[model samples]
Target: MPSSELFLIALATVLALPWLIWRLGRTDAWAPLVVVQILTGIALGPGLFGAAFPEIHRTVLNEEVIAMLGGVASWGVILFVWIAGTELDLSQAWRERRDSTVTAGLAMLGPLVLGGVVGMGLLWHAPGWMGPSASSWQFVAAIGMACSVTALPILILFMERLEILRKSLGQRVLRYASLDDLAIWGLLALILVDLERLGKQAAFLGLFFLATVILRRALPRLNPQDRWFLSLVWLALCALAADWAGLHYMVGAFLAGAVLEADWLDQQRLDRLREMLLLVMMPVFFLYTGLRTEWQLGGASVFAAAAALLLAGVGGKLLGLRLAGRILDWPPGQARLIGWLLQTKALIMIIFANILLDRAVISAETFTALLLMAAASTMLTIPMAQRAMKHFQDQSPEPSKLQSQR
Candidate 1:
């Protein structure tokens, strides 16, 4: 069969299977459609579906077809990350600097510490977990950073689903997550620093700073339609330059968006664009991610590693938020609620692990484990957050009562 025909079949499968499962199984209460899509991606990978239907898998996802699908997936994820960076409400985070900083700091640090410990253990006892190209520190730091990531876009989706996106509590959570988002990207840049390409990386940063200044100034003068077009042009340019510098195109994609003000675009349009991207483009990226999964270390070992990472990621997030709550004098149960919500790691952590894999900073087994951990962590968020929110609402005084008291 022709590669083009196989590619079409593969694309159809990627787009259809996840929606069917999510819709039919009614998994939204515990697992969002995105989580279900991620799981489906894993299931469709060489680990499961490939194992079950080797002949069909080989025929449909041959090298040429996989490469074609990869191109589409790469752009989808890049645009998604760019949108995430653009939507970051840094101004609001600055307005709530003290509280946001403390919460975001602890939230990240706790996971970093715990996950680094886990990384150290993996290095010490199971050296196979580290990629051949990775130095000891690179492997450990990548794992720690992966644990600390909070997917700001995914968090926004969850908050919107929970009906708190425009509420004060949700706004506060966004502030914290936004701050962490900055830190997460910064740490990734640090991890990806290539000594060999030091000059090119430095040059890319300088050029990027200059380009950002020019673009920000120019964007305001253009009509909205032109502004959107120009932004894409900028995204492509930055992505190309970053890849040339060995910093990775996704990093470039993110930085391209981060400098822009959200108010520059129509808020509704931006939201709709994000929704459309999730509905259309991102599932391919999810499927591509699953295709990379390797279980050569044995299924038992992979699951065990994933479980350890999940515990570390979830436990550290809650502990950190609890400390922040005490210090900030948050109302009862608020910290726990916020913690569970913020612990949700789907897209960003997966992207982070992907970069590690791309850089050979982590083994494919480690990447697979991180992928599992991210999916499980995200799956836990909605149910656990609902329970905590219920307890919180029960303890708080009604708005009407407070108004009457006033």
Candidate 2:
């Protein structure tokens, strides 16, 4: 078959499976379409589909098909990260600095510490989790950050489902996640610091700072129509510079948006852009992500590792939030409710793990385990949050009413 024919088959398969499973299984409560798409990607990958239908896999997912998919996936993820960075309500976070700082700090610290300990244990028991180029500290830090991640976009979806997105609590949760998102990307840049490219990275930063100043002055003057075209050009340039600096292009994407004032672009436009990107481009990225999963450690071992990481990620998030709640004097059930919400980690964590794999900071087996942990963690979000909300309702009815009324 021609390469073009194969590419279309692969593309069709990627697009079709998600809708079919989502429609037939109706797994929205436990697994939303995004999560289902991710799972389907794994099922269709070399580890499963290729193993079961070797000839078919070879025919449809040939080298050309894979390369085409890779290009699409890369741009999809880069744009998605840029959108996330633009959505950071940092000014609002700073206005509510005390609450945001305390919560985000504790939330990040608990997972980092616990996940580091878990990484050390894994290193002792099975040393293959770290990549060939990774030092002990790099591996530990990457794993720790992975454990701490909260997928802000996915969290928004879940909150909307719970009918709390417009509520004050939902806004508060967004602030915390936004702050953590900033920290996560900052830490990633730190992790990606290559001694050989340190000069190039420094030069990139200096130039970027200068460019940001000019753009800040220029972007606001342009009509909204022109701003859209320039934004894409800026995004591409920033991503290229970041990649050249040995920081991942995704980091560059985030920085490109972060430096811009979100209000510069119309809020409706930003919302529409995000919706369209998720609706179209991000599924390709998810499928590509699934294709990268390796089962080299065997199914049982990989799953066991995933379970352990899930426990660390979820347990650490809850513990951290609980501690924060104690210090902040939150109401009896608020901590539990917020913890479950913040523990939702699907897209962002997968992106983080993919960067780790691309950098050779972690092996494919570790990436697969982290991906599983992310899916399971996200699946737990809605049901657990519902139960928490229910318990809170039962415990404090009138007060809840009064609060809601406020």
Candidate 3:
């Protein structure tokens, strides 16, 4: 069969399979369509599908076809990351700085400490887990940071599904997640720091600041449509500069969106654009991610590693939240509920692991483990949160009853 025909078949399979499974299986209560898509991507990768049928897998996902899919996936994630950055509500986080900072800080710290221990164990056991170019500290730090990530975009979707996105509690969660999102990228930048490229990186930052000031000033004068177009132009330029500076394009992508005010864009349109991107572009990224997964260290080892990381990530998050609850004097059960919600690691963690892989900070086996951990952590979120939420609501009095008592 022609490569073009094979490419179409590959695309169709990726796009169709996940939706079919999500829609037919009705996994939304636990696994959202996005999670399903991620899992599907993993299933279609060499680890599962290729392992089962090597010839067919190779034919359909040929080198040419894979490259084509990669192009789509790259742009898709870039836009998605940009949107995530642009949507950050730093002003709100600033307003509730004390609560947000404490919660976010503890939440991130717990997972980092626990996951770092696991990373160390992996390093001690075998060199296979660490990438070729990675130092001991880099490997450990990347794993630790992976556990700390909260997919801000995925968290927002979950909140919206629970019908709490606009509520006070949801807003608080968003504030905490937003602060962590900022930290995740900052740490990634630190991890990617290159002594040889230090001068270029410094120059890039200087130029970026100057350009941001000019862009911010110009944005207010332009019409809304022009603002949107110009932002895309900015996104591409920032991504290019960051990559050239030895920072990843994703670092640039996030910075591109971070400098812009969310209010400058039409919120509804931005929301729709996000939806469109997820619907169309992100699945390709997921597929691309799946294709990179390898079981070179053996399936059992990868699964065991994933299980260990998941335990560390989830257990640490809960413990941290519980401590924060005690310090903040939060009502009983509220901490656990917030902890489960924040345990979301679907998109961002995978992206973080991908960068680690690209930089050779972690091996493919480790990436696969992190990917598995992310999927499982995300799958656990909705159900655990729902139960916690129900218990919380049951414990608290209704608004009308409180009013009557008053």
Candidate 4:
């Protein structure tokens, strides 16, 4: 009956509008879905209903919401990981091709190093928007690099829509994307462990990694049903451990993908799993990011800092990709695409930025700037990589020719 309580209910009801539209049979508009949901969350958050109807959010911010959101984020990530593992089928993918491997490696490397360097530089001339951050450049750079990197899930969706997943090159790109995701997420975990003290926070991940080593050896031969059950349990354990460590649930979710159910899970099961993620898991985590992001209205230096970081993030990935390709002796196109694909940043990095802000490791404006850079880089990389891939595919020889020669 309370006015604040009624406002909170109204906010939740408004957020339910998109799904209502979807259920009315219009799911093709994903871009609108994302925008509307995010905008709804923002309106409901402290900015509007929570401001005018301040009493509404007070009760809604209870422990239950946090716990539920935490669980959903955890499960969403696990489902994503499960799907990633399923995509590793290499029938079409050719790892023997020096060009593809070289391309993927370089592409993955470029933004990581570049972002790190730029993040470090911000320490020297503390931007007014960022205020004073307690964290060092190395830390900032690590988070920046992580944010600048791509999401395998989103990229895979693009590939599927293009009918590229059925192609040899597409399969290979997924392989490389898989590897890139592994390496970047791993780096993120290590950085987070260091941030929270490796001794305390790294223990579960280390254990999980070791378990992965064991599973990697056994999964190919395990009974299908057993593999499925064991993998789910492993996923659960990782989630619980991360929650216990006061780390983001995705740490466990990502590791679950990188390590468990890899060889055993197939398309059908993965599809079902993805349904759970899409329907129940990811929305809360992502929409919350949009809502909770603290926007500083007038911060020129923050804008400059954001721009600098974006350039560094993109440029670093490109640089790393080229260097990695050169060292590894990969072909030019493969190197280029890998670098581009790796530049697609998304939800994970934003999560890290929030953590940093929460811990007082960075200032409000700085955090918002980082998120801006992340969004811009993510938007830019996908189309860029697609174009690059088109050009590369055009230059490559047909498989039928090689088959005939053989």
Candidate 5:
């Protein structure tokens, strides 16, 4: 078949299958369309889709078609992460430092410790879990970080869907997630540190800091429209530079937006941009990621591994939040509900695991396990939070609900 025809087939399949399942299945109460899209991506991957229909997979995802999808997926993820970084409200986190610090600290630490232990056990029992490039410590830390991740973007989407994004409890959840977001990236940067390229990474950081200073001063003066374009330019530069420096372009894309003020961009426009990207481009990334999945460890083994990681991730999060509630004297049940929200992980965790895979810090089997855990974790978020979010909404003032809509 012609390259154009094959590309169209691949593209249409990527876009149509997930939406069709989401619409026809009507699994919104348990699984959002995005989660369905993710699962669909996996089904379309080599592990299942290729295994089931090898000829169709090859015909549709030829070299040229795969390359095209890869290019789009790369940019889609970079822009998505950039916007996530831009949305971070560090000032608000600092203002609510006492509560945020205790909650976020415990939330991350608990998972990190438990996940690290799990990583070690996996390494012992399952030799293929670690990548060739990864040292024992790096593999442990990377897996631990994966367990600790709270996908802020997915959390925001779920909160909005639950009509809690603007509520006081919702705002508080955002704060905790925001702080954890900063920590998550910082930890990733640390894990990605190559001693051989230490000097280059340091140079990238110094230059990035200088460039950030100039942009902060210059961006505020620009008309809103220009700032939008310029932000993309900055995003491109940072992504390219970071990839060059061995920190990975995604890291650079994140730093590019993390340094900028979110208020500088029009919030409404930002929201729309995010929605459109998720609607149009992000599925391409998910499909590409799914293409990387391999279940060489066998289906039962992979599922078992995923269950272990899920236990560490979800169990540790709830445990951590319960401890935080005790320390802060929260009302009963608050910690459990918040823990469920914090358990939301999809894109960011996948992004993190992708970095580990790209750097050969973890093997495909491990990546497959983490991927399964992310899908399962994300699937649980809406259903688990629905009851609590509704209760809170009923108690919330009418003005607060209106504010959330805005």
Candidate 6:
């Protein structure tokens, strides 16, 4: 390897150490340490100082290194998906179930409808703005699709912050979000397949579903020791296959999670790998995103449009959760907390935005704007959720449902 490459590797390790230390510090910020990694990366990676530190930057944040870092055992997320599927309180959703499923369904629907509607209306009112760029229905569908998503990791962080990991509300959000990801992935998969202009991929898409169904049934046949090893292998193979199939690796990830079948699996190899990811691999991923993402795109109008979309994203979620809380007659405090949490946008939107950007389905200007919108939405939401939960607590001093989460 070149001297520069070795230095970059050394730099990545040096920068990654703080997050590992922080993870051991017993702070919730440990979960959000990706934020920290990026700050450090910007200081180290090429730009101004990076130009001066060109050797350091090349090794650590260069295309090869970033790809490796960003790709850090993303299978950790895959394992999480598996754990998430197994941990689902289908019973809670079922026995107490009103069409809260429908509510969750509409929670997604309203946003999709609103996003597309807003896009069309804006273009209709102004001529030559984006110049027949985004159609009303396409506007509605894509943006709405983006808006309707809730990030799983963000929810996990919110729960960690509020100390609600074991509560019914937390469980509810996790379950609903899991369902949301499923629906969104299914739709996105279809859209992407269509975009690939690959009719054969369509058959393969159906095959992926059928294969997952068959594999879930077949997985149990392996002996105990073999099962653990084989499962990880299954994850790697499926993940790569999804990538090649033009489905971003999330489909494989979701399937990997959905198949785990038990909590015991988390305590095994998956747990160990997840720990490693949280310690080293994951922080690099975030740092990589922050250090690399271009922030300086677009004029005032694009910023305005992006801003408006984000507000709608946040508002749409809070409104949906609040409405559900009311209909369920959930304690006002808990209901309100739910509103905040629903704003915890997830990975789905970010991934979709990239696909749109990559396909030139949206302008680079619009793409950068929306990408920023996703990051901003994620940043602002954690606080929004925490405060909303707090507000509910203050208004209802009677030890309400929200408190049960703690």
TM-scores of the candidates are 0.96, 0.95, 0.96, 0.72, 0.96, 0.74
Error of 6 at 265 (Å): 1.9
Q: By TM-score, is 1 or 2 better?
A: 1
> Which clashing pairs does model 1 show?
none
Give lDDT tens digits, candidate 6, residues 237-257.
Answer: 766776676665666666665
Q: What is candidate 4's lDDT per residue for 321-344, written digit by digit as tens?
A: 677767876666766776665665
Clashes of each: 0, 0, 0, 15, 0, 10
- For model 2, state the Cα shift of residue 140 in Å: 0.6
- What's the lDDT for residue 400 in model 4? 46
What C-alpha lDDT values do all the predictions have? 0.88, 0.86, 0.89, 0.59, 0.88, 0.57
Predicted candidate 5 versus true structure: per-residue lDDT over 29-49, tens digit per residue? 788888888888888999999
lDDT value for candidate 2? 0.86
Candidate 1 lDDT score at position 156: 86
Model 4 residue runs over 4 Å out of place are 1-70, 81-94, 97-101, 125-134, 194-206, 213-226, 242-249, 296-304, 318-341, 351-364, 381-406
* True-structure lDDT of candidate 5: 0.88
Compute the lDDT of residue 114 as modeled in candidate 2: 86
**On a 0 to 100 scale, what is the lDDT of residue 236 in model 1?**
94
Candidate 4 residue 300 Cα shift, in angstroms, is 4.8
Q: Write down the worst ten-residue block by lDDT for model 5.
A: 397-406
Tens digits of per-residue lDDT for model 1 on 94-142?
A: 7778998999999999999899988998888688899988899989999
lDDT tens readout by residue for model 2, 163-196: 7876778878888998998998898899889999
Candidate no. 1 TM-score: 0.96
Query: For model 3, how does the per-residue alpha-carbon lDDT over 153-236 read when each residue is reduced to its tens digit?
Result: 889889889877766677778888888899989999999998899999999999999999999999978999999999999999
Candidate 3 has an lDDT of 0.89
